[model samples]
Target: FAAVVGSVQDGGLPHAGCRCDNCQRAWADPAARAYVVSLALVDARGEQAAVYLIDATPDIKFQLEMVGEWLGPHPQRPQRINQPAAIFLTHAHMGHVAGLSQLSFESMAVQNLPVYGSVKLVGMLQETELWRPLVSQLDLLPIADEQTIVLAEGLSITPIGVPHRDEWGTGTYGFKIDGPAKSLFYMPDIDSLAQWAAAETVLNSVDVALVDAAFYDAGELRGRAAVRHASIHDTLAFWEKIDSQLVLTHFNHTNPLLNPAAPERAAVQAAGATLAETGMVFALD
Candidate 1:
């Protein structure tokens, strides 16, 4: 069945042109990590469907409601959070999976929600208190660097290794999802573009590649986060060498590229990719 999945990236620099308190307390000291996010993967046809969320941003309530709205008016839809089918965890970052707590008894009480991540990922969640209690409640399925897991019929997801500073889980993963009609790659938070040079075959093979466009220009980040992932993830300069239909995401609050009419857009368009928008939708067939 064809699916419509969206990664809703909301909010911006908390203080606008300056870093917020949250960033000040954090390790990298980003301007702010206050983005209200949640992604929904909808299988509209099967009636029996699934929703795979890439990163569960802090805006949990709103995001979950949005996902339900995206499901549209399905008369026979299951009235349970289990209807979401599954969730593909990208990392253990505070903003990525922090919203899982919302699925507790006070909220949806989502039991047995399949969460796919690296084995190290599972341990990380187990080691942490917030995520540990719910591990048994929600079915947390751990996969390795190269493990391929089937989400649904005709839709298989394979995680590729990528470099990153791992605080909670293994580094990061670049997913290769194959559907019946087309294939897709989601590298939301990668380190640098060079990391894919050796695996160019896989990175360039997809019809649409959702990449990591965290920084618009070099030296934007306050410290390590900025200069760190340049070689493994896609930078504006990184795109110069990449040959694919790229849609960049996991943007830093500092990325001037988020502006639709900004010069960064022009440069991104010229680089053969587009910046990912909150509601933007794309198809492969």
Candidate 2:
């Protein structure tokens, strides 16, 4: 399935190494924007084949190489497939596709890595000077919402829209994956679940959901009480409405999760939700 944490700046990347507490006051230090690359998806045959990466995180080279190794066997032992199935993306943030350039000739020398995204996002990539150049050389494909992308007999992906900063594209989205064994809903970033109309249908249908946990408690960070990011993501107070098994991820430095023993931590556990840990893996199938 999808690979998490691929970035050069481990803290700046979403899925790699975000800790807790970089309050607004801390931003003056230029180190509070902690993040990690988040990529996810499974393949055909209900396996992690045709792995779809949600973002082309900064650590794309090493991450893809790892995916390739897992999908197939190593060169010495070789499995079944030749390459990763595909890649999907949310907004064109630097953490999302910074690895695209590395996939080009100057970097790892990988080939057309069918990257799927919304229409405007595709155009953004095309119109941009850097990623646009990759399209001319690499095989980047475009996709739309509700478009059923068939990876193979048992694996298919349908993009569902979510609201976010759209300067680079229109509405961003979470993904609904259909495989032989089970389904998963992954929305790494969204302003608020209330912003989505079909949020109920999307969350209820999946066996597991990896939702935004960029913030653990509101107003925990100094001077961030009025900031939107401080209030947007699913708060510990709002977990009761969701009916699926939840795994909170996409953490920020200000998040209380950096401390496993915090009251917020106790709150998440009492609610039956799990936290996303680095190097965590699961086989839905």
Candidate 3:
């Protein structure tokens, strides 16, 4: 099964300093708050369940707590939760990899935890003096584009390189996870569907796809520079003919879809696409 630990974009709900209507609602109500996008993949076929986290968001501490049952307890410290078996990163973006600091010596202090990402991403972590200490504490594994890594018997993950804003020349990847009887594709960030040649083919191949829906439309990006995320309107139109269970995630703080009462939210439901929420679980088999 895959668990959605967080559903909002990078900065999360109630963004840094914004006081927008949506942010105001989130600030006033704790229940309305959301964390950055991330997924937890669990395989419980064996005596002890194995758990893997996809994209270590800044909200990792609370996100980890959400899956504490599967993580169990730390072997050495019963009071603490055990670290995930491994973490697969989609990109080096702040939202995706910032949680690594939480696992460093100052916090979780995880030892030899396997962290996988692109060759360039892993290299940056290894070579950068600022991150060298964190790198030393982890087992950095660089995976190639389209390389499939088998986890347990029927559980495997293949990283599919995609087009996204890459300031450091480190490529972005969207994960295709194949479980025993079902498959899931997770792409939290992407510039645009039209830019990726295999967007339709790869997305349709999966049984369920949790894709990027950072903004409701271009109107949400009033004063911002040319943003790259695909709007909800565009995304729905693109996947209208696809049969896969399309779930929208990684919403920006200003997105209208975040409001349940918003007509845009109703429109999305009418289109047969789901709006992802934290703690939502999807069974693989």
After superposition, which runs of candidate 1 have C-alpha atoms over 4 Å from their true positions? Answer: 1-39, 69-83, 224-227, 231-243
Candidate closer to the true structure by TM-score (higher is better), 1 or 3: 3
For model 1, what is the C-alpha lDDT against the true structure?
A: 0.61
Model with the higher lDDT, candidate 1 or 3 = 3
lDDT of 1 by residue, 95-153 (tens): 67777878777766776778787888877787777666677667888888778887667
Rank order by lDDT, top first? 3, 2, 1
Candidate 2 lDDT, tens digit per residue, 1-285?
544543112245323343333333334453323336475554545454456677777766656655664556433434323445567887666667676777676765556667788888777778877566578755556778888887776677888888766664456778887767787877777777776788888888988787776665566667654333413235444556767778777766556664555787786677687877645565656
lDDT of model 2 at position 100? 76
* Per-residue C-alpha lDDT of model 3 across residues 1-285, encoded as one tens digit per residue: 999999998899989898998999999998889999999999988877889999999999999999899889999999999899999999998999999999999999999999999999999989989898888899999999999999999999999998888999889999999999999999999888889999889998999999999988777878645668877788888897677899999999999999878998998899888999998999998
TM-score leader: 3
Global CA lDDT computed for model 2: 0.64
lDDT of 1 at 193: 64
The per-model lDDT (C-alpha) reads: 0.61, 0.64, 0.92
